[model samples]
Target: MVDVQGTVTDGFEPVRDAFAENFARRGERGAAVALYRDGRKVVDLWAGTKDADAPGDGPSAPWERGTAQIVRSATKGVAAAVPLLLHQRGLVDLDAPVGTYWPEFKAAGKERVLVRHLLAHRAGLPALDTPLTPAEAVDGVSGPRALAAQAPAWEPGTDHGYHAQTYSWLIGELVERITGRSAGRWIAEEIAGPLGLDLWIGLPESERHRPGRISDVEPPADPAAPGLRMRPRKAVTDAYDDPASLTRRAFAAISPAADENAPAWRAAELPASAGIATAEGLARFYASLIGDVDGHRRLFAPATLTLARTEESAGPDRVLIVNTRFGLGYMLHGPASPLLGPGSFGHPGRGGSLAFADPESGISFGYVTNGMQKNVTADPRAQALVRGVARALAG
Candidate 1:
């Protein structure tokens, strides 16, 4: 067995072993996983190489494991929570028309759209009508400019679609408009700092060395196959091109998906994407939600956590083109969910990154990896680790 170099709290040994099994079975090059239950961490383990192409590197060395890794779309759950937190503080309202916050959003018949609609992935604007460069997408001004100028794919609030790259800009702008601080800064100061976790929306320059170099995603043999959950047409033009392509143009500079270890990418405050953290930090972030964390709660009220866990949308997604159930700011557990049972709520990244809070059983599980996989949502290997945590909780 490839020994991982992290600590596991007592009573969650099964979860530790289960993660080990998945790491070995899948030939995981680099990965980190952490779980918390009842306001306490239960499972924390990581192993393997930073890049799949360099697997001969021993997993036994503590220095071999990566740190401050990117978690991809999992950043959305954390980002969306910012507005919800503001709402609870009486600074913003979720039911109010979104245009009330950003006047330009009134263009394109989006005047009636509510803030909840954005949280639900029903605001449309899934695809840009015109091709946008990654620079345009992340340039503080360009993202909102394009969103305000573009037309919605469908009527807002009438249909659900995975916003893909647009979600971060949508919510991040709102947080900035409301709080006068970038979503990344707010999250760093309000959420991560208060919780004493190392998670980052935009990474810090000093933390760059901690992350493993990102490896290229394996390309599918056939793009037309039904096995594809996010089709080519469904993705932005910059998503992927040519076989064995390592980088997506979508993250050219300031986008959340920026280079695995670039200084600018780490410094920019993109709330919807580009979060960097350790599994321990992510688990600590969620652990605060499960209960009082040393008597300090980042969220304004406890009931807000309930709102986050409750279902908001479930049906065919306009962008993903599949049924997706979502809570206020997180992905709820469902038949198609990667997490085990309905009590789990978290987000999964396009590659192999995952984070969840199983409040019913008081469990939080997080996994971060450098290896990029073809599957977007249905990676059984991630779910298997979640299931193992569930069994440990039950036992």
Candidate 2:
């Protein structure tokens, strides 16, 4: 068995057991899970190897308490706060047209796209006609420029779809235009730094050789792992398989996929995808969103917190083809997303990373894994840990 490490308050032993079961029965390789309740750490655990750089049946490096990894689309939740924070400070108007901030955005049909529309995934600019090459995608200017030139797939705010790769440029460009700084730098200085968080929007060069330098994990070796597997959905599979489908096109907006472990990709701030964080850092971030952290002030005021969980858009997502719920950039608890509770809000990475906060329960949770799986929103490994939290709360 892969030995689990870290501590949990007395009531959280169920979470430790769940973390162990993930490796023993759920096909979890290298993974970590953490949670904060009422602003204090309640669960922190890690298990298995940091196989991001290691490969094959070779001896593996042990996963450490401070290890971090790219959290894929989960980055959206972290990046979402940037614009909202700006709005909180009266620097950006949520209802105003995005063109009000970035004039060139008005050149295309996007003139009608409002700030809230972008947050709600209703800007209707999911798939790109001309996708960016991996190099161009991370070049900073190329992404936002490409998105600015494209016409919307639907009328802005009339419908909703997961922006997928386009979201990086959409949110990142707005941050740059507003702060005159890169999204990564802004997040580091404003959000992560103040909170003393081990989170990074774009991983830095100096951090590469640091004690917990992150790398990409290998894909699942067994799709039919006994503990959990995908519920067969022909429609979901068909949509993704078809090149002409919006689902496929939206995900393909980055064209040739970038190697996530590549330093270049890590150094460039793709706010939608390139976030790197340890389990605790991510959970602590969510804790501060819903309440104070260790007596420190929270990032979201009550009004802002309400804005984050308010239903901005909910229904069949045009790109995902699955019924989804969104509040600004945060994904709400729903059928497709099994977060903590009805009041929960956060985003999940494409494969195994997940994080969220439930103000009603005073719970902020995060889980990250090197065991990339076919599961998207509610990875079984993550849900297991979440259920453990529920058990702890019950007692």
Q: Write the per-residue lDDT of candidate 1 for residues 95-193, one digit (tens) a residue.
A: 999889889988987888889888888787665655455556556888887777777767888877677677778888888888899889898898888
RMSD of each: 4.8, 2.5
lDDT per residue, candidate 2, 108-174, as tens digits?
7888899999999999998889888989988888888888888999999999999888899999999
Backbone clash count, each prediction separately: 6, 0
**Collision pairs in model 1:** 29-49, 36-364, 37-362, 160-318, 168-272, 203-266
- Total backbone collisions, model 2: 0
- What is each predicted model's overall lDDT from 0 to 1? 0.69, 0.86
Q: Distance (Å) between predicted and true CA of 104, model 1?
A: 1.4
Every model's TM-score: 0.86, 0.95
Residue range with the least summed lDDT across 10 consecutive positions in model 2: 220-229
Top of the candidates by lDDT: 2
